[model samples]
Target: MIRWTSSRALPSVDDVILLAGFGLGLSLIVAIGAQNAFVLRQGVRREHVGVVVAVCAASDAVLYIVGGAGLGALVEAHPGFVTAARWAGAVVVIAYGALAARRALRGGEELVAATDGAVPDAGRRLRPVLLTALALTWLNPHVYLDTVVLQGALAASYGDDRWWFTAGAVLSSVVWFVALGYGARSAAPLLRRPGAWRVVDGVIALVMVAVAVSLVAGA
Candidate 1:
């Protein structure tokens, strides 16, 4: 009556899946970047947050699937890819930094609608979201190393139930984006205040500049 299965030898299946997903989600969410910053800005300004959230979540899901399918190794093998990505990311970070700094220097009312004016038609918005997500997810060798390659490798450690782990990880991105996009709206009141907006934007600018510098140095 002492027969034991592999499942019993380790953590429960659900726990494994949750842990993998939660870890991946948390790791990706920590950094301040264009996509997330944009989302937060939009949320505060009362833009089309649902669509924005959907776009982010959808793009992330697609990339994660590609990674989980084992395409990360290809990215890792290409040093050129990483080098180019770092440069590109640097450009984005610097540009974002400039924008954030401008907003911070200006008053809240001026900054509130800054991002809103930049929105294109529905089609254009979707294009940017997809492209940005792709660049962020694919072009960046780090994403490949972390999400696609490393996460995939870990998921594979589960053998037959790896899919469960993958699903959890994907869900993490979904949940976080939704929460962030929505939660950011709470800052609208403060964002309405010119002084407060300046402070927030100042922080955004600093973060972006730092990221850009780091990228260039690392490259």
Candidate 2:
């Protein structure tokens, strides 16, 4: 059995556990990364933002459940699996970074025009966009490291309160995705400028490459 009771001046152990999970989840997921850049782009374009947000949040929830259920232990037991995933993920991210860098080099005008054209035809491209979003989420090795291995080990430490911790993490995912996807519209005015788009894409490219290099070096 788990307890949620708290004294007059202190939080209950369960409360502390939940807060910790939420903080950890937020810290990991809120970082600038490939998945986030994709979501922001789609959101700014007003193209399939709902689908993107739903998929990201749902995927996080599923991973959280898997981690809480001990997938982390399974992963730990297989060094070969980790090595393969790391290399594969690094390749994918590096490829993506190269694409982004190419686009950034094309200048802001091309980026703006492309975004504008995509917005009008967004409904026709939903399938491909969704597929890309899924790939971005599932192909990233860091997602597994943060959500599965790290969070799982942390949750396990909570013993009987692990489920509550997982719930908090899931909530954090829901909150962050919703905020990022929906709130991006407010930046439309700024992003309308070609220079702004170039800067954004350049930053995204750098982040992707940096993450890829770190993954390869760690492996």
Candidate 3:
């Protein structure tokens, strides 16, 4: 996955493991969640996009590093942490979902691209945005259940090349977050119409509530 193979240089078995990690990580992280929805909203607003993307990518990289380093085992041993996170995540996600639903119903929100003739909305202060991003990432139980636990178990299947697998997964996180955040920014202009923005918010609301429901049901 890192590079194409040539006749002179065949790919090693570990390379295959790395590629597997990259593919699996991307597939898992791309799922709809409160965090991803918030990232997209912030991206559309062009508010702290760089910081949000960095926080997400760096957090995922940390999870992958720890997952491969036995932190997964520790997390598994303590079920209470997961339980608490699940409840907390559900609460926060539900609240966010309700807010999004209200905005969608009200239909006042509209996108203003930086390229627009007038100044675009600057959005909220940096501190609140930063805190919200952090909370959405760390408080979510999926970060532990799906990422650390499930991915770590899969990484173990690589045996001696587990770290390579972890590295590839980490790379996927960085690439996905960068693409999602900046990609949304590029599409901000498409949401200039209030109707389009309302649709985006409605979609985000559904995703957030869906995630919350999943967490509650699983718990």
Candidate 4:
């Protein structure tokens, strides 16, 4: 009988750093589900984009660390954890969907135009972005899997030196959120028109509803 021993292969320094960061960042974000849309909307408004990004990045960092620390195993093992997350996520998504439906139901005539020189309502500016960001982060199961389980698992793939991988992943989250928040700001010109704002709001509502439906269906 021939016995085969598994050799632990370590990823190259460059590869580990790049892959870990890229994987973590992309996993947490890069999806046009609920969060990204909200962020983009806020960015266009030039209101509280920084706050939204900060919250999102911070949330990701915490969750990623917890997941990397093997907390994901607990989530996976405990049926209650999944149940709670799913229910919580479902409720959040539904709420967003309802908001979107309301916007969609409102005709284009009622839409506000985005004018660069004109000031926006302060309350409107902050509430939507913050609420959307929170909903995206809290409601989506994929977000957990991406940051916590998947990112952590990727970091752990480095055998013994998993910290290096995790560092890269964490960095990616920061960079991506900052970029996303800032990038959205650049589109303010296009988003500021009343018609444009209405359209954007309508789209957001549709996406929210669709995502909510998906969550319920999956559940």
Candidate 5:
């Protein structure tokens, strides 16, 4: 079992832990992935960006809480679980990367978002959009690795201040998702160009593959 330090060694709160959590959380969450891509797309299209952001942020918080509370300890106890998750995550990420690469090569022409304030008639309904957001957030095995296993283990290192670490991580998730979801609108004009979207997709594909490779190598 993973041993945590006693609360007696910690103050009521620690700024260092909080700052560390914030920085680490931001670094991990900022990576390019399907969730980020979907959020950006929804933001650019101006279709239920709020809902998508909320769902993502909330889901992350839950995962972080689970990790920080005790799941990290459980994960540390079971190396086999980590191995299984790593391989599974790699496979999923690779598949997603291939799809992204395909889109970059052949689907660029359909990348335009509705420029007007009004949602396009063909725009996805709220239910489907929310469901997609949930799927992308939860279905990705990397999420568990990053939030539950990695983040949890890291937080445990902080001893009694683990929850504070988690709070900072949660805050980072909220800030990042909100910015990515809302700030994406500013890039809408540029993304309207098929070439620009192609570039974005290509970058996403590269990122996905890189992450997958990293997981495999680390495992």
Candidate 6:
């Protein structure tokens, strides 16, 4: 084997910072929350999966950039912003949970079953999906705490290397959302029956309610 060991062969400072950013970003994002619950549901339903994924990925990227640019530090100073977000997020999640509970009560065929035996797009409308996706990503206080505050602080620690960290974080976010939304298709086979959808909606409702409680408690 040829010996290629050298300082140049080792990871550079920027490379290390990038990986650190990516690792930290993934660690924070992988936690399941109401937002994730919604995404998984959309993915399983095969409805607006791409829209959900895109919204999440794009929102994360924008937040990361803002944080990296020092918005995180500013947010830390204004605690009221987080407090407001918490209350709003709690209300939104509670309402969403109720909708989910209703769905769980209603069987799958009944959910989108056509009255006239004609094929109909039973999934939710695109505007509502877009709005909900935006709300989940933006209204959630945890998003600011993790992406803006913590991630921003970490990025600032890199000084001149902050942008590299940001790039890595954005990449990590994109990969995660893509995987979460599309990878859910693998479970499609298991969700073909009305019972399976009920179970899923039930679980999602539970997740939403739990998230609401946590938001209130944290506030």
Encode model 5's per-residue lDDT on 66-85: one tens digit a residue: 98878446546764555665
Each prediction's Cα lDDT score?
0.59, 0.71, 0.70, 0.58, 0.74, 0.70
lDDT of 2: 0.71
How many pairs collide in each candidate, listed in order? 1, 0, 0, 7, 0, 0
How much is the lDDT of residue 21 in candidate 1? 55
Candidate 1 runs further than 4 Å off? 1-11, 71-141, 187-219
lDDT winner between candidates 2 and 6: 2
Error of 4 at 151 (Å): 1.3
**Lowest lDDT block of 10, candidate 6:** 110-119
TM-score for candidate 1, please give it. 0.51
Candidate 3 lDDT, 147-206, residue by residue in tens: 676666555444456688788889889998888787876665665567775776677677
Question: What TM-score do all the candidates reach, one by one?
Answer: 0.51, 0.61, 0.61, 0.53, 0.60, 0.60
* Candidate 1 lDDT: 0.59
Q: Rank the candidates by lDDT, best first.
A: 5, 2, 3, 6, 1, 4
Candidate 1: count of backbone clashes, pairs at least 3 residues apart or interchain: 1
Q: Ten-residue segment with the worst summed lDDT in candidate 5?
A: 113-122
Cα error, residue 195 of model 6, in Å, equals 23
Best by lDDT: 5
Q: Candidate 5: where are CA atoms >4 Å away?
A: 1-13, 71-123, 188-219
Pairwise lDDT winner, candidates 1 and 6: 6
